[model samples]
Target: MDTGVAIFPTHDAIAPADVARLAEQRGHESLFFPEHTHIPASRATPWPGGRPLPRRYAHTFDLFVAVTAAVTATTRLRVGSGVCLVIQRDPIITAKEVASVDVLSGGRFEFGVGAGWNREEMANHGTDPRVRMAIMRERVEAMKAIWTSEEASYAGSHVSFDRIWSWPKPAQRPHPPVLVGGDGPGVLDRVLAFGDAWIPNHAPAGILERAKELRARADRAVGLIVMGVPADPRVLEAYAAAGFARAVHWLPSAQRGPVERAFDAFEAAVAEFTGE
Candidate 1:
C-alpha cells in the first residue's frame, strides 16, 4: 500500500511548496490538499463534524494553485486535491486547469473530485444541492471529453457546450486518474461509472468487502483510497489487507510542527508495516 498525506493549505499553514518538498524528502508517495472555493456564512447546512465549520475551510487556497506550487517544489511526489468540489465548478474551465496542472506536473496529478456537503455553499455557486450528484457526473464527463478530444464539446442535461479546441492536453495519456470521493450508494456508482478510483473517508467495518464485491461486478480494478486514516501501523496493515491501495494521513492543522510530527509518525509506521 502507498502512503500519502492530506492537508488543508490555509493561509495559516505551512506553504504548499514547503509541505510538498518536505513530503518528498520524507519519501512519501503523494501530497493531497482539500479545496473550498469559498465558505458560506449562512450556516444553513450543519457542519458534518457536528461543530462550527473550521476556519481552514474559509481560508483554504485554490486547489490547482496549491498543486502547481507542490509540483514546482518536488520531482517525484504526486499532487492532488483530496476532494475538489466539482459540483460548483465550470467543467470546461476545470478541465483546462486539470490538464494544465497534469502537464506541468509531468502526469503526476490525481484528480480527486466530490459533490460537496454544504447546501448553502452550493447555492452560492448557483448549484442546486438537490441535483448535485447529477451535476457532478455531467461535469466530470464534460471534463473527460475535453481532456481526451482535440476539439471537445459536451451537451448533457446539466452541462452543454459547443465544440471548442483546448491545448496542452494532460501529460498522462487520456487523462489523470479521476478519483471520486464520497460514501453513499450513489457516490459508489459514480465511481464505477467514471472514476478510476474511490476515495472515501475511513469507512465502517465490512465497507471494504462490500466495495470489493461491487468492483468485481463492475469488472473494474478501481482502487480504494482512504483519507483521514489513523496514525497506527496495525490500522494501516488492516486497511492494506482489506484492499486499500492508498491511505492518506490527515493533519489536525497545518502548523509546521504538527505536520512534521504527523509525517514522521507516518514514515515510521510505514517502514514498520511494509518494510519500505
Candidate 2:
C-alpha cells in the first residue's frame, strides 16, 4: 500500500509548498489538505471528538490554494482535498478549479469530497443540512458533466445549468479521481454510483469490516484511501492486508520546524512499514 499525508494548512503552519517538497523527497505518494470555509463560533452541533474544535479548523487556508501550492512545488506528488465539502461549494467554479489543478500538475490530482457535518455552517452557505447528501450528489454529478463534455449541461433539483463550455479539460481524461469520503450507511453506494474511490476516516469503528466488504466486490473496482491514520506499523500492515490502496497520515498544523520533525517521524514509520 502507498502512504500519503494530510494536513490542515493554516496561517501559522509550515508553508504548503515546503510540505509538498518534503513529502516528495521523503518518498510519499500524495498530499491532501482539507477545507472548512469558516467555522461558526457558536453552534449546536457537537464536535465528534467531544472536545472543542481544533484551532486549525477555524484557521485553515482555502483548499484549492493550498493544493495549488503543493502541486506546483512538486511534480509527482498527488495533491487533493482530504474532503472538500461539496454541499457548500458552487459546482461550476469548483469544476474549473479541479481541472486547472489537474492540468497544471500534469494529471496528479485527487478529488476527495464529503457532505459535511456542521449544520449551522452549511446553513451559512445557503445549504440545508438535512438535504446535504442529495445536494452533494447533484453537485458532483453536475461537475462531472462539466468536466467531461465539450458543451455540458445538468438539470437537477439542487444544481442546474444550460449547455456551457469549460476549458482546460483535465489532464486525466475523465477528470481527477473523485474519492467519496465518509463511511456512513450507503456511502459505498455513493462511491459505486459516481465516485472513483472510497475514502473514510480511519476511526469511529466498523470501518475495517466495511473495507473488507468493499474489497470483496469483484465486479467493481474503486480505490480506497484511509484518512487520519495512526503511524503504527501494525495498523499499516493491517490496512495493506485488508486491501487499502493508500493510507494518509495526519499532519497537525504547526510551525515549520515542529511540523517538519513530525514529517520525519512519519516518514521513518512509513519506510519501516513498507520495508523501503
Candidate 3:
C-alpha cells in the first residue's frame, strides 16, 4: 500500500510547509491535514477518539490554508484535507478552494470529505447534526458541479445555485478525486453515491472483509485508503493483500524533533511493506 501521513496542524506543530518538504524528501506519496473551524467548548458532542480531546483539535490551522502551504512546499507529494467538514462549509467557496489548489499544485490534490462527529461544533456552523449526512451529500454534489461545468448549477435541499461561472477549472480533468471519509453503517453508500474512493479509519476486525464487500458492490474500481493506521507491517501487508490503495499514519501535533521522530518510525514501517 502507498503510505501517507496526516497531522493536526496547530500553531505549535511543525509548520505544514516543513512537514510537506520532509514528507516529500522521505519519498512519502501524500500528506493530509485534518480540519475543525473551531472546537466548541460546550463539550456536548463526545470526541470520537474519546474524552480529553487533544488541544490540537481546537488549535488546528485553517484546513485550506494548511493544505495550500503543504502543496506549495512540495512538487510530487499530494496534499489534502484528511476530511473537510462539508456540513459546516459553503460549497461554492469550497469548490473554488479545491479547484485552485489542484490547479496550483499541478493536480496533486486529494479531496477527502465527511460529515463530522462533533454535534456542538456542527451546530456552531448552523448545521444540524441530525441532517449532516444529507447536507454533506448535497455539498459534495454541488462542488462536483462547480468543478466540471462551464456554468455550474446545483439544486438540492441544503445547497442551491444557478448558472454560476467558476474559473481555473482544476488541472485534473473532471476534478480531483474525492475520497469519502467515514466508517458509519451508511459510509459505503455515501462513497458509492459521490466519491471516487473510500477512507475509513483503521479498525482491527472485519475491515478487510468490508473492503472486499465494497469492491464486490462497486461496478467500477473503487479505491480504499485506510486512515490512522498504525506503523505495523503485518497490518499494512494485510491491507495491500486486500487491495487497499493507501495507508495514512497520524503524526502528533508537535514541533520538529518530535514530529520527525514519529515520521521516521512510520517511514520504517512503510519501508518494510514496500521491501525497500
Candidate 4:
C-alpha cells in the first residue's frame, strides 16, 4: 500500500512547512492535516478515542492554512485535510478553498471529509448533531456542483442556492477526489452515494473482510484508504493484499525531534513492507 502521514498540526508542533518538507524528503506520498474549528470546553461530548482528549485537538491550526503551508513547501507531496468537518462549514466557501488548493498544488489535493462526532461542537456551528449526516451529504453535493459547473446551483433540504458563477474550477478535471471518513453503520451507503473513496480508521478485526464486502457490493470500483495505520509491516502487507489503495500513519503533534523519529520509524517500516 502507498504510505502517507497525517498530523494534528498544533501551534506547539513542528511547523507544517517543515513537516511537509521532511515527509517528501523521506519519500512519503502525502501529508494530511485534520481540522477542528474550536473545541468547546463544555465537555458535553466525550472524546472519540475515549478518556482525556489530546491537547492538540483544541490547538490545531486552521486546516486550510496548515495544508497550504505544507503544500507550498513541497512539490511532490500531496497535502489535504485528513477529514474536514463539512457539517460545520459553508459549502460554497469550501468549494472555493478546495479548488484554490487544487489549482495551487497542481491538482495534488484530496478532499477527505466527515460529519463529525461532537454534539456540542456541531451545535456551536449551528448544526444539529442528529441530522448532521444529511447536512454533510447536502453540503458535499453542493460543493461538487460548484466545482464542476459554470453556473452552479444546488437544491437540497439542507443546502440550496440559485445559479451562481464560481471560477478557478479545479485542476483535476471535474473535481478533487472526495474521500469520506467513517466506519459507522450506514457509512458504506454514504460512501457509495457520493464518495469517490472510503477512508476508515484501521480496525483490528473484520476490516479487511469489510473492505472486500464493500468492493463486492459497490456499483463501480471504489477506492479504500485505511487511516490510523500502525507502523507494522505485517499489517500493511495485509492491507495491500486486501487491495487497499493507501494507508496513512499518524504523526503525533510534537517538536521536530519526535516527529522525525516517528517518520524514520514509519519510513523504515514502509521500506521493509514494500521490499524497497
Candidate 5:
C-alpha cells in the first residue's frame, strides 16, 4: 500500500514546491491538490458536507498550476489533482493542460476527476446539474483521445470535435492514470468504462467490502484510492486489508509549519507500519 498526501492549496497553506520536496524526501508516494475553479456567491447549493462551504474553497489555487510547481520541484513524488471538477471546464483546454503537465512532470501525473456537487457553480459554467455526470464522462473520454493521439478528435453527446493537433503527448504510455472520484452507483460504472482507478472521499464504514464487490462484478483491475484519511496506523492497516492501493491523508493546514508537522507525523507512522 502506498501512502500519499493531499492538501487544499490555499493562500495560507504551505507552498507547493516545499511540500513536494519534503514529501519526496520523506518517501511519500504522491502529493495531491484539490481544485475549485471559483466558488459562486449564491448559497443555493447546500454544502455536500452539510455545512457552509469553507472560505478556502473560494481561495484555492488552480490545481494544474500547483501540481506543475510541485512536479518541477520534486523528481520522484507523483503529482495529482486529488479531485478536479471535470464538469465545469472545457474538455479541449483541460486536455492540453493535462498533457502538458504529464510531459513536464516526466509522466508523474494522476488525473483524478469528478462531477462536483456545487450546483450554482456548475450553473455558472453553463453545465446542467442534472446531466453533470454524463458531461463529465464525455469530457474524460475526449481528453483521453487528446492525450494519446497526435491528430486527436472526439465526438460524443457532450463533446464533439474535428481532428485537431496537440503536442507533448503524456510521457506515460497511453496517458496518466484517470482516477474517478465518487461513491455513487453510476460512478463505479464510469470507472470501469475508462478510469484507471476509483477514488472515493471519506467513504462510509464497510466501504471497502462494497467496493471490492463492485470491482469483482465489473472485472476491472483498477485500483481503489481512498482519500481524506486520518494518519493512524490502525486505519492504514484496515484500509490495506480492505484492498486500498493508495491512501491519502490531509495536511491540517497548508501553512509551512502545519504541513511540516503533518509530514513528520506521517513519516513516522508510515515507517512504523512498514517497519522501516
Candidate 6:
C-alpha cells in the first residue's frame, strides 16, 4: 500500500507549503488537510473522539487555500481535502475551486469530501444536520456535472443550477478522484453513487472487513484508503495484506519541528512495513 499523511490546517501549524515539500522529498504519495469553517462555542453534537474538541478544530485555515498551497509547492505530491465539508459549501464556487486547483497542479489533486459531523457548524452554514447527507450528495453530483458537462446543470432538493458555463475544466479528464470520507451505515451507498474511492477512518481489521463487504456489494473493485492511521508497521501490514490502496497517517497540527519529527517516524514505519 502507498503511504500518505494528513494534518489539520490551522493558523499556527506548520505551513502547508513546507508540509508538501517535506512529503514530496520524503517520497510520500500525498498530503491531506482537513477543514472546519468554524466551531460553535456551545454545542449539542459530541465529538466522535470522545474527548474535548481539539484546538485545531476551532482554528483551521480555509480548506481550498491550504490545498492550493500544498499542491503549488510540489510537483509530485498529490494534495487533497482530508474531508471538505460538502454540506457547507456552494457547489458552483466549489466546482470552480476544484477545477482551478486541478488545472494548476497538473492533475495532482484528490477530492476527498464528507458531510461532516459538527451540527452547529453545519447549521451556521444554513445546513440542516439531519438532511446534510442528501445535501452533500447533491452538491457532489452538482459539482461533477459542472466538471464534466459543457453546459453544466443540476436539479436537486438541496442544489439546483440551470445550464451555466464554467471554465478551466479539470486537468484530469473527468476531474479529480472524488474520495468519499466517513464510514457511516449508508456510506457505501454514497460511495457507489458518487465517489471514486472510499476513505474510512477505521482500524485495519475493521477496514479489511468493510473493504471486502464494499467490493462484494459493487460490480467493480472499490478502492479503499484508511485514514487517521498510526505510525506502526503492523497496522500498515494489515492494510496491505487486505489489498487496500493506501494508508494515511495522522500528524498532529503543530510547528515545523514537532510535525516533521512525527513525519520521520511515520516514514520510518512505512519503510519498515514495505521492506524498502
C-alpha root-mean-square deviation, each candidate: 1.3, 1.3, 0.9, 0.9, 1.4, 1.1
Least accurate stretch of 10 residues (summed lDDT) in model 4? 205-214
Q: Candidate 4 has which clashing residue pairs, if any?
A: none
Among residues 3 or more apart in sequence or in different chains, the pairs in candidate 3 whose N, CA or C atoms overlap within 3 Å are none
Q: Sort all candidates by TM-score, best to worst.
A: 4, 3, 6, 2, 1, 5
In order, what lDDT does every prediction score? 0.88, 0.89, 0.91, 0.92, 0.86, 0.90
Question: Model 5, 170-192: lDDT tens per residue?
Answer: 88989899999988768878888
Tell me each candidate's TM-score.
Answer: 0.96, 0.97, 0.98, 0.98, 0.95, 0.97
Q: For residues 126-157, what per-residue lDDT tens digits would candidate 6 score against the true structure?
A: 99999998999999999999999999989999
- In candidate 2, position 23 carries an lDDT of 89
Model 6 has an lDDT value of 0.90
In the range 1-276, model 3's lDDT, one tens digit per residue, is: 688999999998899999999999988899999899998888887788877888888898999999999999999999988899999999999999999999999999999999989898899899989999999999999999999999999999888889999988999989999999988899889999999999989999878888888988999979999999898888899998999988899998899999899998888888887788
lDDT of 1 by residue, 1-276 (tens): 888998999888899999999889987898999988888877788878899788888998899999999999999999998899999898888998999999898999999999888898899999989999999999999998888898988999999999999887999988999999988767778888899988888855756776677578677588888988887888899889888889999875567898898888877888888866
Q: 1-276, model 4: which lDDT tens digit per residue?
A: 678999999999999999999999988888898889999998789887988988889999999999889888999998887899999999999999999999999999999999888898999999999899999999999999999999998999999999999888999988999999988888889999999999988899978888888898899989999998999999999999999988999999999999999998888888899888
Whole-model lDDT for model 1 versus the true structure? 0.88
Displacement of residue 234 (Cα, Å) in model 1 is: 1.6
Pairs that clash in candidate 6: none
Better of 2 and 5 by lDDT: 2
Which ranges of candidate 1 are over 4 A from the true structure?
none
Q: State the weakest 10-residue window (summed lDDT) of model 5.
A: 202-211
